[model samples]
Target: MDAVVIGAGPNGLVAANALADAGWDVLVLEAQDTIGGAVRSAEVIAPGYVTDLFSAFYPLAAASPVIRDLHLEEHGLVWRHAPSVVGHAFPDGRAAVLHRTVEDTAAGLDADHPGDGDAWVELHRQWTAVRGPLLDALFTPFPPVRAMLSVLRTQRAAGLLDLTRLGLTPVRRLGSENFGGDGGPALLAGNAMHSDLPPDGAGSGFFGWLLCMLGQDVGFPVPEGGAGVLADSLRRRAEARGAQFRTSSPVTSVTVRGGRAVGVEIAGGGSVRARRAVVADVVAPALYGDLLPRDSLPAGLLRDLDRFEWDGGTIKVNWALDAPVPWRAPGLAGAGTVHLGVDNDGLLEAAKDIALGRVPEHPFLLFGQMTTADPSRSPAGTESAWAYTHVPSGLEWQPDALARHVDRMRTSVEEVAPGFADHLVGEHVQSPALLEEWDANLVGGAINGGTSGLHQQLVLRPTPGLGRPETPIEGLFLASASAHPGGGVHGACGWNAARAALATQRTGRRLRRALVGTAWERVLRDPRSPR
Candidate 1:
């Protein structure tokens, strides 16, 4: 094969598709019998209900350039959105809703904070100016000169500095500064918690703003039937392009010959030789620390790998409800995704609990209403709902303790819907240990691949100076969330890795280098540049 992608997760599958589209022979190896690592959906909860077992809502998928370019819709990928994208429903029956258009969303915010409507519109205006290029800069490789230029075309250097501040701003500050109350900030904080980052952390604001804006622009749409449909579409596209997939074929190691990745060794028996590239859709620690031999790695790189920290754990619960959640805040019933029973203080308190290794009694919950978005997820008059929250890692998992946590989580939901428990037909829990066991890629249940804090981001992602996907070893690249642009359902990491791998062939690398180098030189010559 021209390329051997080790792991048939979204990133790996997308990378294989990209390679095959470019007319390369690609082979994708999967550890499990299925594809879609954490993106999988199952009827694990009850009959007639298809719940997203891992990742349910996909704002990133809706906004992804690669997913758009791939045209998965033609390949049977349909996105379903609720009337409202996201809602933050507090205990007091006050809700902050994010609608499809900025105007509608702003008007919703105005109810709590007067003129906060204008603030939201202004934020969206700023997002419009640089949204395209900002996403390009984020997903593309480091030193993305073209992306930088695209943003500069719309925004001045000062505006760029402001954008940088959005990334550096704490999530709490971002919400408070832009609006008058906790409604807006709660919405942002809830979304930011999708990462391992705390609301107070730097760069958490970027996640908050990005998700909030994306939710407004394109509601957090899910596939019609289930999340698996999206994965199946990706697989079908790849297969049509002549990519081959091997399920239950766990790769033991990358066959390195003379410091270059040659292929992969299968766990039980054979080997798949890659004529060109070996894309590891696995996490960074597993790639550098676990797979490669000691001598194959440099001391400095190993030390950095040792310092690599995994994100907090997660406990997910899925339910088959006889009816839509009877939210105390009636507005929440219309939203596709609802964050139940919490405000900013509650969010911060949850984060603090996770930090302190104490399970929160009233855990802040990220609620998803599957049937609200897609009726196909359940039978008529029924709903498929799920909620998940982050927990501290390294705690010993006992079945009883996990059960207790699940009970608390259930109580958190009941706090919102008041007698929501009476509507449940069936329920299933996925603890951190169970999540890790389900998919090895979800190491320690750090779903975004790792903690996406400021320190772990940029070139320091995975390790310092290693976020570009290209590794020190020839033919080997990080093509997963462990690479740049940390997490979410977006396939940017895979696309970027595939592009880098393609660059390794022909004079593509040289051409790209020349283009970037020219841009760098021009920027260096600019007196007003921040370089």
Candidate 2:
């Protein structure tokens, strides 16, 4: 095969599709009994209810150029949206909602706080001005020279200095500076909580702002049937182009000969050869620590890996409800996703607790109303819902501990949606360990591949190396979210990796590989080096 893509996650499948579209022979190997690593869905929550195992909503996916270019809709993929994009439910019978349009969102905020509507409008206006180039810069590979140049050219469009200042400011400060009340600030802080970043963390303002604006632009859309359908569409499209997939085939290691990835060793003593490239959609630590031979890896790379930080562990609870969530705040019923059971200050407190290795008394929950987003998620009159919260790392998730955490989660929900528990037909709890079991890349249930904090993002991601997917080894690329641009449903990570692999073929292969090896050494030895 021209390429052997390891781990059939969305990134891996995207890499396979891109390579196949390039007319290269491609094969994808999934360790699990099924495809769609974190994007899978099943009826495990209850009979007739389709619960997304991991990620569900996809505003990022809708905005992603890589995913858009494939036109998955041609392969039977359908996008569905709830009436509202996201809602932040307060303890009181009030909610701050982000609607599909800026006007509606602003109106909601304005009703909550007089001047806050204009503040939101100003923010969205700034976002609209820089949206194209900013998204280009984000989805492009590290250094993003072309896209950055485009952004610079459009600086006057949105005031580059002001934009930069907002991007660097902490979300907590940004929200307060712009809004007169907590309603608008709560939306920003809640969105920032999607990452491991705290409300006060530098560079969190951009993430919060970005997601909020995207919600207004595209809405937090989901597949019409289930998230798995989106994955299946990608697979179908790739298969149409002749990309093959093998499930239940776990790759033990990447076979490297002469410091080049040549093939992969599958379990049960089977192996597959990749005549050109090996794109691994696995986690960075697994790729460096377990897959490759230790001797072949740069000592500096291994040293840096030791300092690799994952996001906090997550506890996800899925429920098959007999009816729609009896949300006291009626505004929340229309939202596909809800940031519930906390306010701005509460989110900050929870972040502090997670940082201090203590679970929050009232965790900020990222709740999804699946049936609200897609009616097919469950039978009529019922709702398929899930909520997840971050906890400190290193919890054993023993039965007693899991039960307690689960109850804490339920209580958190009940605080907002009064009769939440009464409607539960059944529930499924996925501890950190269980999440890892289903998707190995979700190390300790830390989603977004790794920490999305500024310290660990951009060029510093995975390790202090070039944000590009190319590793020190030739013909090998890191296509997982651990690469630059951390997490989300967007396929940029995989697209970047596949494009990098293809570039090797067009360029002088030997010379380029040798140069890359030299650059890798310098980067590994001195992360600050610009060799």
Candidate 3:
């Protein structure tokens, strides 16, 4: 085979498709009996309801150039959006809803506070001014040289220093400084909490602002039928391009010869050779320690992997409701995604609890109304809904404790939607262990491959001096969420890896391999150096 992809997740599928599009022979091996990793959906909650097992909304996917350029829509992928992108409900039954248009969203915020709406409009203006280049920088490879230059070129059009300052600001401060009301601040802080980052953490402002702006640009959309439909669309596109897939095939380890990846060893007792490359869509720990021989990796690289930080653990609950969620706030009814049961202070408190390794009494819930986004998710008048919350990483999650945490999530939802539980016809809970069992990439229930914190991001991701896909081993590449740009359904990691492999093929192999090895060695020599 020209390339052997170790996993059949979205990233792996994207990689296979890219290599195949390049006219390279490609084979994808999946450990699961079925493909789609976290992007798959099923009717486990109820006979008529299709519940997304992991992720539901796809703002990132909708905006991703890599995913969009694939034209998956041509392969039976239809995007559907709810009337409202996101809704945040207050305790007093009032809500802040993000509409597709800036005017509508600003009008809603203006109702909360007179001048806050104008402030929101200005924020969106700044985002719009630089959205293209900014997104390019985000999804591009590390050092993002050309993308950064594009962003710099916009300095005259948009205030470069001001954007830089805002990007580095904490979400808490970003909100307080920009708006005069709860609506604006709640939206910013709530979106920031979507990740492992607390509202006060550095760079939280950028994430929060990015998501909020994306909601305006492209509504938080979903597949017309189910999330699995999106995965299937990608699969169909790859297959049309002649990429082969093998399910129930687990690659136990990557075989190396003379410091170059040659093939992968299957679990039972077989091996598949890769003439060109082996793209691994697994997490960092599994690749660095479990799959590859330890002696093949530099001792310094192993030490850096030891410090690899994973984001918080996650617990998801899926429900098939007999009726729509009886949200007390009328505005929340039409939103595809909802952030509820927490205000600015409550979000901070809950974050602190999770940081301290204690489950919060009222965990903030990221609830999704699948039926709202796509009516086909369930039968007429019924709803398919799910909610998830994060807990501290490395918790035991014993039976009783897990149940209590799940209850806390339910009760939190009930606070905003008075009769939420009463409408449920069926319920399915995915604990941290269950999540890991389903997809090993979600290690310790972490949806993001690794922490999105500043310390572990950029060139420091996976390990210092290695954020791009090319690994220490020749013909080997890391194409999982653990790679650059962290976690999202964008498929940039896979795109970068495949492009890197193609670039190496065009260039001479020995010279490129020697240069890469020397670069890693030079940067890794000083463990304390951030560079």
Give each model a TM-score.
0.95, 0.98, 0.98
- Candidate 3 is scored at a TM of 0.98
Ranking by lDDT: 2, 3, 1
The lDDT leader among the candidates is 2
The sequence of per-residue lDDT tens digits that candidate 3 reaches over residues 1-531 is: 999999988888889889999999999999988899889999997798998998889999999999999999899999999999999888778888888899999998888889999999999999988889888888888879888888888777349988988888999999999898898888888888888998889999988999999998987999999999988998899999999999988999999999899999998898999999999999988998999998778777888888999999999999999999999889899999999878888888889998898888878889999999999999989899999998999988899998888888888888889888888898899999999998989998999999989898889888898678888888999999999988989888888899889988988797786777678878666454322
RMSD of 2: 2.0
RMSD of 3: 2.1
Q: Model 1, stretches more than 4 Å misplaced?
A: 508-531
- Model 2 regions more than 4 Å off: 526-531
Root-mean-square deviation per candidate? 5.0, 2.0, 2.1
Prediction 1 TM-score vs. true? 0.95
| Candidate 2 local distance difference test against the native | 0.91
Cα lDDT tens digits for candidate 2, 349-414: 999999999988888999999999899999999999999999998778789978987898899889
Candidate 2, run of 10 with poorest lDDT? 522-531
Per-residue error for 385 in candidate 3, Å, reads: 0.2
